[model samples]
Target: MNDKNDLERLRIQIRGAVQGVGFRPFVYRLATNLGMVGWIKNSAEGVWIEIEGTRSQLDLFLLKLEQEKPVHSLIQQLQASSLVPLDESDFEIYPSVSGEKTTIVLPDLATCSDCIRELFDPNNPRYRYPFINCTHCGPRFSIINALPYDRPNTSMNAFQMCDRCRTEYENPLDRRFHAQPIACPECGPRLEWWDHHGKRLASDEAALQAAIQAIQNGQIIAVKGLGGFHFMVDARNSDAISTLRQRKHRPDKPCAVMYPSLAAVQKDCELSDLEAQLLTASEAPIVLLRRKANISVLERVAPNNAYLGVLLPYTPLHHLLLSALNFPIVATSGNLSNEPICIDEREAIQRLSGIADAFLVHNRPIVRAVDDSIVRVIADREMILRRSRGYAPLPIALSKPVPTCLAVGGHLKNTIALTIDSNLFVSQHIGDLENQATLKAFKQAIDTFEQLYEVHPDLIACDDHPDYLSTQYAQHRSSKFPSSQIFPVQHHHAHIAACMAENGLEETVLGVAWDGTGYGLDGTIWGGEFFLANLTDFQRVGHFKPFRLPGGEKAIREPRRAAIAVLYELWGEAAFDRTDLTPVQAFNAQERDILQAMLQKELNTPWTSSAGRLFDAISALLNLVQISTFEGQAAMALEFALEHISTDEFYPSVIHQGIFDWSTMVEEIIADIEQKTSGAMVSAKFHNTMVEVILQFARQWKQKRVVLSGGCFQNRYFSDRTIARLQAEGFQPYWHRHIPPNDGGIAVGQAIIAASQLLKRGG
Candidate 1:
């Protein structure tokens, strides 16, 4: 006790994902074990600690702190200096300090192994508890109201801890120590089951049983989960799936299934090492897997989709609900078509009443609506299809620090991003801002992020598309802030930039952008594009030849119209009578005449080089999809057509003057169909042709790093094939893994691109 001469005190501040992840408890255990007196606490900036210890002990403490930090805690910065000691007698954790929060908020984690074991353990107090969670797992961002993350500011605030749980929370050696969302059945939220008419059916165990019974009875139930509600039904029930699809007005969009166990998932789908790892990872994202031929899963759940989107039960409630049933449930987002996920209990019951037969309700309020994150293995690596719930709020690190900025994202798959210095915090998947409710949610997200991260935008970025709600949001932002700058980024450019930003690559690279549509600089619609790009600039090096859409937006929904345009371009008047051109057979004489006139006069017709439109046209010509019920339905069908096919043949095309001439390919494809070519061979060759086109650009640009992005890349066949071909040609092809390759990931690119431009202007 009298070793004062050798003793020292230090005030250390740590930043980065250091909150809601047991960081303070980690420090407490380490300090107490080392016989050091200290007080640790969470703050807006990060963790702050005051330690008094001998020189050698302090040195050992620092070493272990770096080497043995909490598994989920990522220490971005740690600053230490000698300071006056508080003369503390024992290590302790003080209440979190609130003000300007900079420490990262943790994403909601999937059930940890220990928690999973305790869930099923008969001897455990929390056995079979629907809300069981601990420090290592359970909800975080989805439940957080604000940060300096603490129970008082989360959805868990209403659930006061019982004595035993409180003791565990206060004990540094216990795993639940300082866990914000810690709860057990005794002092936690309970469940309720309600009929569509708002009559309560049952409670607790009975409620769960009723929910499962409803599903087994071929009824769709809106079940509350971690982030929001999910529409649940027996995956094997074709009638229920069709009924739900009809009620939801989502005729062909694939529904995600939640299996009870890993064994069940493996039995239904072809699993690979990477896919299996991703499915079971802490995020517990829905992974697209090749479905087994003999599985009882109804095709109605995912018609024409080559891969089934599947996820394991990630939460205690999910585990319990799945445990009560023998079959997997279709756990799709609780929203109509393109609406933001439903979070409020009453709102869910009201809005989803038409689609869901019953509601599996809960008392705990969700702070935000988060759709389940989605991923797929492409070229043996993970590619995020949708980012939300279990993989959000945690910022993506930039190559260097930049000023505060906000990006409002695209009109479809909207996700807003905010940057404070080097950390780029992209919000959870905000649904397409087409409806008032979704737009309100998007606005709320902007406000919430501004308050949470405590940063005002120096600039805002969005798409150049004038009609996009995101563009309007940015315009309004500039007007409201007055001093804020606004950057209107091209759509395809943003798609490519997102992948590049996530990879932290600043150098110029070859970017291949293909999706439904983007506003081209020359007053035409663009989608198939190749660019030589860096953060600050991009040069359009190559693109698909523009073709007119017979009825503009109408052509997007009706693939037959796009096919008519392609055929009209190819054969003029002769295309209408071609007996092999079967898409024409689906149209009436009047409709055909009107479509032909629309194409000839180019009235209400817009030209686009979109690879997506091309896919739609090809699918229509083959009579696979004459009219689409969903945005990518035709393209999805085309990808599905590749199943059980092996071919090296491809329709030939040429590139001249930076424009890819697909006329030869289109003409040949028509001729092949007339010659009775199989759809599988045509689909395989179509995919192969895309690979060849990308390879041509890769070779011509001479950039080793090729970035493949845009919604078109969401097709597994196209993305995987293109990536494999590029890699084999000795090019390092960068594809999206965290942010979606679709519009959901576009905001990140918009943010970084604007940041780079701002830095250049020294703003």
Candidate 2:
């Protein structure tokens, strides 16, 4: 036995992503195995533990704790100190205690391999069970209603565990120990099949089989998922997909396909080692991969796109269903176009009745809806195009701490951000705020985050645009919190700031923000812009030449309008007679006359330097897309057309007085079109010219670090080439990886900028 002088007590406080991840059990087992006596308990802040042992024993305990923690647990902060021995006899786990909140909710995880094996094993009690989960995996953020991450605070509280399951839960050696969503078929949620008319058709196994049969018959089945619902249909069923497109009012956007396994995905798509790892990762996000040759059967799913968004089975139900079938299924969000995804069965039925023939739903209520995350490999790195579901509500580490703040993101692709200490919590994709349903969902998401984090913001940040729904909401909320300060950030600045924040850059960098549109500080529309910026402030250094957008917002939906506007700006009224131009031929004399008048009188014409509008104009001139059916349709088409084509040749362009004048490039493109040049060559030349413009500016500015942001960077071809060129030219280049390059990342930028400014003011 060790002497009393050799014994010591240690008190440890650990924070960040510790709860509901089997952390306490892991600690209990470690302490007991080391012949130590201690008590561990969950707390509002994190986990608190006290252990008494010899000095060497305590040292070994700390070492093992650091070396062999749970897979999903992240120890952001840990403090251990010497204390007087409490004379404890045995290791024990005490109940959780209440305190000031500091911890964050972990993102919902995809089902784990252990659970999957148990699900399919013949002798396992949960064999073929759809709701099987253990401590290492399953839902956390979606079903959670409050903090401290216990079963009573989650939707699982509605179902008390069976005696057998309870014994496993209480056993520290078992994998299901303290797993909040732990359940078997006899004690957990069950699936049901319902008709579009709210009539129940089948339950449990029958329901799963019925959904599969309906899918094989080329019928749309709305399946409730971990975070929300998905509309599942056979990817090869062209007629069924066409019907879904027609009913959902989504004609051109590509749908994600869920294959049975990674090997299955490799057969149809070109998958790299990294891509395969990402596909099978715990997040299980939809990864855009290049399609292999001779895969025409899936053409209806992705249309003319060169890449197919693919995902593996993430949930047990998905696995059970896919394993029983040979064909892949198209899994798209279950909602009408432009609306938030539905989480409730009744809501899914009411919103998707006309589209879905049957509904496969469960009784475990999702506290909030989260759409699937979308990712792609650009510049040999993973870029998250849409952050949700398996990748959201997880805090982004910040470099510094500031006053509590809430950032209301832009109108399109809205997502709010909340700050606690040095962690930034960016919400999932909230979609466009045009409809009441989306707007209401946006508010509810904010409310849920605020409640979950217990954050009463002392400041609010929003886009400077006066009329944007997000800005208006910020203003409206400021009245409710009279003590809260409101800070309106410029739109393009937020884009750049978001990039800087994502990269943890505090120093000035060349910020290249190119997107479809943003409200400029000069009362114009800015999209293509360059700024010398840091987190707190920015200086506008360069931008594209301004051009008129005829009919304002209407021009965005009609590429022909932007095409005509560019042509008119070049040759004035003389250009209208050029019937050889596709945009000119598409518009009749009356429409041309009206457009000319709008440009001349400046009525309802907004001047913009948007790179996205420029791409739209070029697409129209190429006769590829004269009208857009979706937000990024024309631009995506432009990117698709230039996929494999390469050309070092660039068109003529000039930079004078911080303005990139592409008039000569436009003239050259028109000449190439008149000369019957290939569309690929023209697109290559245009892309080359744009890359050269940024390069020339970077050389002139003498900035070694360049940050690229905005929606234009989402084009993989452009981003990959630009990054390669920048690195070859001996410059550090940074683009978004975790956050989106679009407006979905605006809140993160706003939050960081606001926090930086507040720190400067000593707030």
Highest TM-score against the true fold, candidate: 2
| lDDT of model 1, residue 612 | 87
User: Looking at candidate 2, what is the lDDT of residue 668?
Assistant: 94
Model 2 residue runs over 4 Å out of place are: none
For model 1 the local lDDT of residue 656 reads 88
- For every candidate in turn, the CA RMSD to the true structure comes to 1.8, 1.2
Q: List where candidate 1 sits over 4 angstroms from the true fold.
A: 54-56, 84-88
- Return the TM-score for each candidate structure: 0.97, 0.98
Candidate 1 per-residue C-alpha lDDT over 690-755 given as tens digits, one digit per residue, 9 for 90 to 100? 889999888888999999899989888788888888888999999988889999988999998998
Model 1 CA lDDT for position 653: 62
